[model samples]
Target: MKIAILGAGYGGMAAAFDLLRAGQDVTVFESAEAAGGLAAGFKAPGWDWSVERFYHHWFQSDAHMLKLMDDLGLRHKMLFPRPKTVMYHRGKFYPFDSIPAALLYPGLGWGVNKIRFGLVGLYLRLTNNWQPLEQTTVEAWMRKWAGDSVYREMWEPMLVGKFGERYAQQVNMAWMWARLHARTTRLGTYQGGFQAFSDDFAAHLRGLGGKILFSTPVTALQSEADGSWTVRSAAGDQRFDRVLSTTSPGWMARLAPQLPEDYLKGLLELKHLGAVVMVLALRRQLSPQGYYWYNLPKSAGFPYLALVEHTNFVSPEHFGGDHILYMGDYLETDHAYFQMSQEELLERFLPSLARINPDFQPDWVRQSWLFRTPYAQPVPLLNHSRHIPAVRTPLAGLYFASMSQVYPWDRGTNFAVEIGRRAAEMILTDGQA
Candidate 1:
């Protein structure tokens, strides 16, 4: 069987690898000149650094990703970086990575509030069943233990920032369980950077007799009455026994118009949050605190949302002793900040870093770049499970396996790879792949 996988991101790559292992002819089509989709990288001008187009990291529970690295013989390149996280609350920055920190953190109160809050976390981790809570709002779930004061002062800001106002109130409590499960321990990165994973994965795919076509975007996909699907790309059209799409749901909805009208409408109804990130290669480190920091600012004054001091987490020597900084923000595509030129965005983002470290002069920046992802994240509204797409589409021989299917589970490289493998297994079970 000839299987064509669209989008060479984590999900697409996983699908290709799984299909190849199943003794099927597999080919992957990537729109970008490189694989990795959102995680792809490019060379910076002055510093000569190679990094991901967007910031990415793997959590402790990312077993599938770890297994993939081992299978590809790239396991030795993986390194666990112990980076702490600080939350900016009410004109103050509080370290909040561990239970001890939370207990001592003043922003969340010290007496009954803190004790009750800690109990809530214990329940989330201990509770094997989370379905009953899935139907409940996150606001209600948190409010139950943390109380209204702690919810408003500590949790609401971050929730609102991640999922816009409309969806913030609707997020499932199970989502919090997944988040806590994944983020319990340390985070992993490659020896050089995440971009290294992309390079190695592409090479491994080629070595396994798999074909990958980069800079080739599939313009359309249609299934014939005879059950063969034709994938039309910039290069040409190719017929395949199966076509698995790991691209954005929005992209899939546009490309596979032959899918059921209800499915298409469901995909179209799902909204995504876009991101604008300014990555800087600097001469000196910015934050004195040893980790990533979320700057709330004076209530959304500037476009900058989070600051990642690359050197603080990973060694600067890995990038030839250069300090790297990332200032990230999320917005709708048409938002004013999203419309700003790279120069304008950088000009606005730099001052925030400068305030963090007085010594962070603009001249210290040897190179800089802007990465904008239009459909980087899905916004899960209240009771989002009903809207989740199935693994199979209405059209035969076509499958949908994007991040949207992993509702309540946040989007990440780990989830994408899991979804891909599961999608392939489903097809094989049905005697398709």
Candidate 2:
């Protein structure tokens, strides 16, 4: 079978990997010059390592990501480190990585709030049944079970930071449940970077005779009377036995107008948030306390949702002794973060740095890079599972898989790989059928 995969992101690549291994002729089309999609990275001169454009890491619980690495023979490149993660409280950063740290968190209060929060967390962690939880919003559920103060202090800011004020209260409880159920304190990363692993995997796929057309965007896709699909690009139209699109639902609808009107409308109705990240190389370390991750809620007057000291997680040695830090947030397309120039954003975020370190100065920055993606986060509204598009679309020989489909579990490379392989399996089965 000849399979065409759109978007050389993790999902597209993973699908191609399985299809190629299954003896299918697979060709991947990526808009970017390299693979990795949103998770791609850039390298600078004098740097031994490349850093993710949008900062990323894996959890020990990410079985799909780990298995792919093991299959790629790059499992040894995985590094799980106990980097300190701090949550903000009354002008101080405190560790919240373990049970004790969570219990000791001053923001949750010393009495019933903590008890309720703990009990609620334990319930969500232990329960395998999450379908029922989708009926209620995280805001309402947490407020009812964990108490208003607990919800206000902990969950609200993070929710707002993720989905923004518009959809924050609309996000379902199952999304929150999947997050706690899937995450681990020991964060993992590739020894070099995610891009390095992706590049290596692409090379390996090419060795297996899989064709990856990086920098080639699919201009159009439509089914033909002969039962094959035409995938048009700058290179030329290519007919394939099947087509899988890993692009956002909006992009998919635009590329393939033959999809039903109702389906296209449904695709456009799915709301999502973009992500803006500012990566800085500093002459000195940003977090003086050796902290790697910091949660700064907007409710606490913080402009950004997170401040990640990447070098603290890896090492400055990999980046030529320059410290790496990332300040980022998920926002609506109209948000100022999406529109602002990097210089403007730097000035706006600089004061927050002073708050993090009173003696800090702008002169400490060596270089900075800003990255923005419009479809970074899918808003998990009430009863979100019902809206997720399947790997096999209503259109014959046309498939759709995106981060939006990885519901209950938020977007990550692990689930991306998981969904991609699922799509590949369906394609192979349908071909056989």
Candidate 3:
């Protein structure tokens, strides 16, 4: 069967790889000039390794991604680094990676508050069943399990920073539970970065007789009377026995208007949080204690969500001895910060960077890059699972697979690959039937 897979991200590419392995003809369509989607990377002239536009890292629990790397013979390039993650509250940064660190930190207070915080963390980490927690809000769960002190000092700020004002009573506890359970203290990344992995994946797919069309966005998707798919793009129209879309559901709705009205309503009901990240190539490190992630509390009065010193986790030597930092925020698309220019964003964040390191100077920044995406995060509300579209859509020859389908586990490269493979399996099974 000839298949058309839209979007050349990990998910789409994964589907193509599986289909090609089954002796099916596959073609991948990517709007961008390159692949990898959100995990895509860029490089400077003197840099030997590429850096992701937005900060990215893998947890030890990312089994799907690890297995794929091993299968692709790229597992040797994986590096597991134990980087220091801290929290900024009351004008100071405190290490907050482990239970001991949280207990020792003054932000959560002493005695019962500390014990409550530790117990809450333990509960979240040990939890494997998320169905019961789906209807509960993170705010309510945190307050009930950890008390108001812990919620205000630790979780609330982080939630507000990530979800803005909507996080107070809207975000689900299942999302939080999954996040806590799926992440480990040890973080992993490829030696050359994810873009290298993606490029290799695409090349391997091509070697398997699959075709990838870059810089070609699917403009329209039409269903034929005989149960085939017509995928229209700038490159031209092509007929495929099956078409799987790895783009966002919102995008799928636009591309294929023939979808059922109920399906489109479900797609529109799934909310997404966008992201704006400012990547800086600096002459010197910003964090004095070499912390990789710094979660800012509302008390800190910082504008952005978190400051991720990428070079702190990896090494500056890979980028010609320049320290790389990411000032990133997840916000609604209408947020003013989302509309700001690179120069304007840099101006606003530079002062905040100095607060982290008083010695930070304007000349310290060698170069800066800004990346913005409209669908960075899928906001999981109560009973979000009910809204997830089926891999097999109402259309006979068309299927939908996207980040939104990877529920309970937040959107990431690992789940993307999993969903993509599942979509391919569904297509193959249906074809056999």
Candidate 4:
């Protein structure tokens, strides 16, 4: 049997690896020259240190990722540490990660609001799970728990920052549950870098005789009369008994319009928020404890929404005692922030830095790199379930393994890999049936 997987992202790579293990011929096509789509890493010009454009970390619940790393013999490099996360509100930083911190948090009032917030969170963690969250929007859910004041002061800004204008009134509850559950951890990263897992996965696939074609963008797809799909790319076309797509559903609608009109419409309707992350390699560390801090109640015209003092979480010595900070913004593609030049973004970032770190100066910045990923995150609005396209399309010889399928679960390497494995199993069984 032959299989073709599009997009060398986690889902595609996972599907390719599993199919190869099943003794099937698998080929993966990636538009970029490397694997790890959104998770890909880039090294500095002269340094061995590398980091992902967007931050990535693993939680204890990410079983598939942990298992995959163990199987690949990269377990030794996996480092699980008690990472610190804080929140910035009213020009003050507050620790809000641990349960103790939650109880002691002063930013939130000491009244019904705090009690309601704690109860809702506890219910979410202990009972509701992610399934119930799917049926309601975050707005309604939050209002039910507390009130408009809490939502306005605490939640709305976060929603806007993460989802841009797509922070619809009816954003899905499942999305919030997944975010809350999966994120309850100290976080872990590889001793080398998060990309190490991607590199290892690609190498394992190659070792298993799976072919990966980089710089290959699938422009069109058609199902032949012979009950197979022929995927055409810049390189050429190939016929596969089974086809799986991990590309964003929006991109899928553009590449292969064979799906139903409504499905395609939903894909088009699915909104995404873009991001521009400016990474600064500095001569000195930004924060004292090297904690991750999210700027809340986003100030007007701030260049970045959050400042991740990575060195605070990880040792600066890892990057040769130099601090690495990530200042990121979530904006619409049409937003001026996206079109701003590197120098313009830099100019805006400096003032924000001085606010957070009074001693921050231009000379402290050794180097800066800007990264922009279009359609970076999907906004799971209230009716998110309705927006997700079916995995098994009406057409034959086609399947999908996408982040959209992991609806209640936020997009992650672990979820993508599990989805790929599940899709592969279904495809194999369907073939036999």
Candidate 5:
């Protein structure tokens, strides 16, 4: 069977890889010039490695992603680094990545709050039962079990950071559980970065007789009377035995007019948040204590959600000893940051850096870049799992895969690969039938 993959993201590429291994003819259509989708990156002239436009890292528990690299014979290029992650509380940053660190942190104050926090964490870690968690809001669940003090001190700030105060209440507990349960202090990345991994993945697909068309945006998916699907792009319309769309639900609704009205409505109904990020190449480190992730809270007068020093996580030496930092936030599509230019955003985000490190100077920043995406996070409301779109759409021979469908699990590269391969298996099974 000839397969067409719309969007050369990890999901699309993973699906294509599986189909190619099954001796199926596969072609990938990408709007961007390269692969990795949201994980795509760029580099400086003197830099040997690339940095992502949006920040990305893998947890130790990201089995699906780790397995893929090992299978691809690129394990040696992977780096697992122990990076310090801090939470900004009151006027200071406190180390809070591990259990011991959390207990030692002063924000929780007393014994009862600490005990409640530990018990709730133990429950989340020990139980594989998460379906019920989907029905409960993180706000309610944390308050009830972890108590108000623990929830407010440790979790509420992060909720505000990720979803803003407006949508934070609507977020379910399962999403929060996955966030805490899946991550590790030791983060993983490729030697040259995620972009290099994507390039290698694309090259590997091509080597296996799969065709990847870059700078080709798929405009529509139409069904032929003979049962095949037509992919219309800038190049022209081409027929395929099966087609998979790795775009957001909103894009899927836009691209496939042949889908059932009910299906299209469901796709349109999926709620999501966009991201605005400012990446900087600096002459000196941003965090003096070598902290990698700073989870900022709006309550503390932070203008953004997260402040990640990528160079601190890995090493500045890989990029000609340039300190790299990312100031990012997840906001509604209409947020003002989306409209702000690099200079405008810098003005808003930079002053806060001095609050972290007193010596931070504007001159420390060498170059800055602004990146914004309309679909960065999928909002998981109560019983969100039930609302998740199926990989097999109502239309025959056409499948859907996107970050939105990665419900109960936060959108990231690991689940992208997992769903992509799972969808590919479904397509092959259908082909056999």
Candidate 6:
């Protein structure tokens, strides 16, 4: 069987590997010059390791990604480090990584509020069933379980920062539950970098007789009457026995117009929050207490949502003694931030960096890069599961897999790999049938 994958991200690459292993000819198409999608990294002249365009880290519980590493003989490169995570509130930053930190932290308040916050965390961690939780909004659920003060002081700012004003209120509790359950204090990263791993994975797939076309975007897709797929790109058009699209639902709809109108409507109805990240190579570290991640409350007056010092988590030694920091914000497509240049963004955020460190200055920045994506986060609304499209579409020989489909688990590379493999299995089963 011949298969065509619509993207070269972790999900598409995973599906390509699975099909190739099963003796199917596979070709993957990627719009970017390199692979890894959101996990893709950028390297500077003096840097020995590539840094992700957007900040990325894996949890200790990312079983699918861990297993993929083991299978690829790259498990030894995985490193888990306990990095300090802090929260900024009322003009001060405090440690918020562990339970003790939460209890001691001043922002969450004292007595019953703090106790309720801890109990809510435990409940989210312990609760396995997400079906009931899906019906409730995060705002409502948090107010009920942890009270208004905890919700307002701790969660509301973060939610508003991420989801924006339009959809923040509609965010479901299941999404929050998944986020709380899936994360761990100990964060994981590849020893060299994620890009290094992705490059190696692509090489291994090529060794298995799979072909990947970088910088080649699939412009259109059509379903032939004889149950085959015609994938068109600027390069040319090629028919495949099966086609699996790992692009976002919005992108898939545009690429494959032959899809049913109802399916296209479903795809269009799925809203996503985009991201803009400014990666800075600094002469000195920004966080005074060596915090890796700092969640900024809305009251901080910063333009960005969070401050992630990548070198604080990984070592500065990898990047020629320069500290790496990522200031990221999630916004709707029409947000004004997306239109701003890197220089403009820096101008807006540089003062916030100084606020974190009084001695900080623009001269400390050695180099900087800006990255933007239109589909960084899928907005999980009330009963989002019912709206999630099936892996197998209505058209035979055409399939879909995306981050939006990885519901009740939050979107991540681990679930991307899982959904990719699931799509491959469905195709293989159809072939058997």
Steric collisions counted per model: 0, 0, 0, 7, 0, 0
Cα lDDT, all candidates: 0.79, 0.91, 0.89, 0.78, 0.91, 0.90
**Residue ranges of candidate 2 with Cα displaced over 4 Å:** none
Rate residue 361 of model 4 by lDDT: 84
Greater-TM-score candidate between 3 and 4: 3
Stretches of candidate 6 off by over 4 Å are: none
lDDT of 1 by residue, 1-433 (tens): 8889998998888878877888889989998988888877766544334677778888877888988877778888888877878777555567877788878788777788887888887877777776676787779988877799888877777777776666678777777766765565577788757666787788888888899999999999988888899999987989998889988888998898878899999989987888888888888777777766554642545456678886777777667778888888776787677778988888877776655766777898888888888887787766677888888887778898988787668888888988998988877776633
TM-score of each: 0.95, 0.99, 0.98, 0.94, 0.99, 0.98
Better of 1 and 6 by lDDT: 6
Cα RMSD for predicted model 5: 0.9
In angstroms, how far off is 63's CA in candidate 5?
0.6
Cα lDDT of model 3 overall?
0.89
Expressed as tens digits, the lDDT of each residue in 215-247 for candidate 3 is 999999989988898999989999999999998
Q: Give the TM-score of candidate 5.
A: 0.99
Give per-residue CA lDDT, model 6, range 1-433, as digits (tens).
8999989899999888888899999999998998898999988988899999878889999998988888788899999989999888778888888989989989778999999999999988998999899999999999999999999988888789889878889999999999998889899899778898889889999999999999999999988889888899967989999999999898889988878899999999998999999999999988878999989866678889989999889899999999999999899978888999989989998988878899998999998899999999999999999999889998889999999999988888999999998899999999899
Off by over 4 Å in 3: none
- Writing each residue's lDDT as its tens digit, candidate 4 over 313-392 gives 67776677678889987778888878889889888888777767788889999988888977677778765776677777
User: Model 2: how far is 155 from its true place, Å?
Assistant: 0.8
- Against the true structure, candidate 4 reaches a TM-score of 0.94
> What's the C-alpha lDDT at position 393 in model 4?
72
lDDT (Cα, tens digit) per residue for candidate 5, span 1-433? 9999999999999999899999999999999999999999999989999999999998888999988888788788888999999977778889988889989899998789889888888888878889999989999999999998888877888888888878888899999888877777889999899999999999999999999999999998889999999999998999999999999999898999768888888899999999999999999987878999998888988888889999998889989999999999999989999887888889998999899888999999999999999999999999998888899998889999999988778999999999999999999999999
